[model samples]
Target: MASLLAAVVSAVVLALSSMLSERHCAFGFGGFQCNDPVAGYGSVLLTATLASFAILIVSALIATWKLVAWFRAR
Candidate 1:
C-alpha cells in the first residue's frame, strides 16, 4: 500500500512538473507558436509526457500484481 501511494504521488509530481515547464515556455502566443530557432520542442514535450504516462502505468500494473499475489497467498 505504501508503494502504491508513493507511485501515485510520483506520477502526480511528474505530471505537474511537465505542466509547469510547458507553461513557462514562450510559445503561449497563438496556438503552439514558438518563435525559438530550436527545433523539436513539441516533440520533446510529447516524449516527456508519454514517458511519464508509461511510468505511471507500469507502476500501477506492478501495484496491481502485488495486490493480487498477496490476496492469493491468503
Candidate 2:
C-alpha cells in the first residue's frame, strides 16, 4: 500500500516535471508553435516520465495485487 502510494506520487512528479520543463507561451508563439527549451530535454523527460514511471506503476500494482492475494489466501 505504501509502495503503491509512493509509485503514484513518483508518477505524478515525473509527469508534472516533464510538463513544467517546457514553458508554454500562448501569445509569444501565437498558439501555433509550441516553444519548449531544448526539445531534447523535453522529449527525454516525457519519455522518462512515461517509461520509468510506467515500470514503477506496474511494479507497485503487482506488489499490491500480490499483497492482497496473500492476505486473502490467509
Candidate 3:
C-alpha cells in the first residue's frame, strides 16, 4: 500500500516539474537543459528534482523493507 502511494506521488511530482519546465523554457523537461532561464528558475527546478528523487528513494526503501519482512515471515 505504501509503495503504491509512493509511486503515485512520484508520478505527480514528475508531471508538475514537466509542466513547470514547459512554462519556463521552450524546451521540455526531458531535454534536461534550459538556456536563458528567468531569475530563480534554476533554483526552483533543482528543488523540484531533489524532492522527486527523495520521494523515489523513500519509496524504494519502503518496498524493500516490506519484501524483506515478507521473506522473514515465510
Candidate 4:
C-alpha cells in the first residue's frame, strides 16, 4: 500500500513540475524564449521522473525477491 502510494505521489509531483515549468516557458521571453524557466524545468522533471521510476522499480524488485527468499529459507 505504501509503495503504491509513493508511486502515485511521485507521478503527481513530476506532472505538476512539468506543468508549472511549461507555463514558465510559455511566458518567459528571450530571443527564442531563451530566458524561460519552464522549458528547462519541464526537461528536468521528465528526467527526474524517469530516473525516479527506474530506481523505485529496481529497489522494489530487489526487496520483494529478498523477502521471498527469506521466507523460503525459514
Reference-based lDDT, residue 43, model 3: 59
Q: For candidate 1, lDDT tens digit of each residue in 1-74?
A: 86688578768867864674466444555544332443336556555556777777888888999999999999
Candidate 1: list runs displaced more than 4 Å.
Answer: 1-6, 17-44
lDDT of each: 0.66, 0.62, 0.71, 0.57
Per-residue CA lDDT of model 2 for 6-72, tens digit only, reads 6777777776765654553222443323345543355555565677577677868877888999899
Residue 22, candidate 2: Cα error in Å is: 5.4
Best-fitting candidate, scored by lDDT? 3
Q: Return the TM-score for each candidate structure.
A: 0.52, 0.47, 0.52, 0.49
Tens digits of per-residue lDDT for model 4, 1-74:
45555556665766765565455643334322313544445446556657766656765666677778879999
Candidate 4, overall lDDT?
A: 0.57
Model 3, residue pairs in steric clash: none
Deviation in Å, model 4, residue 72 alpha carbon: 0.9
Question: Among all windows of ten consecutive residues in candidate 2, which has the lowest summed lDDT?
Answer: 25-34
Q: Provide the global lDDT of candidate 1 against the true structure.
A: 0.66
- Give each model's clash number: 0, 0, 0, 1
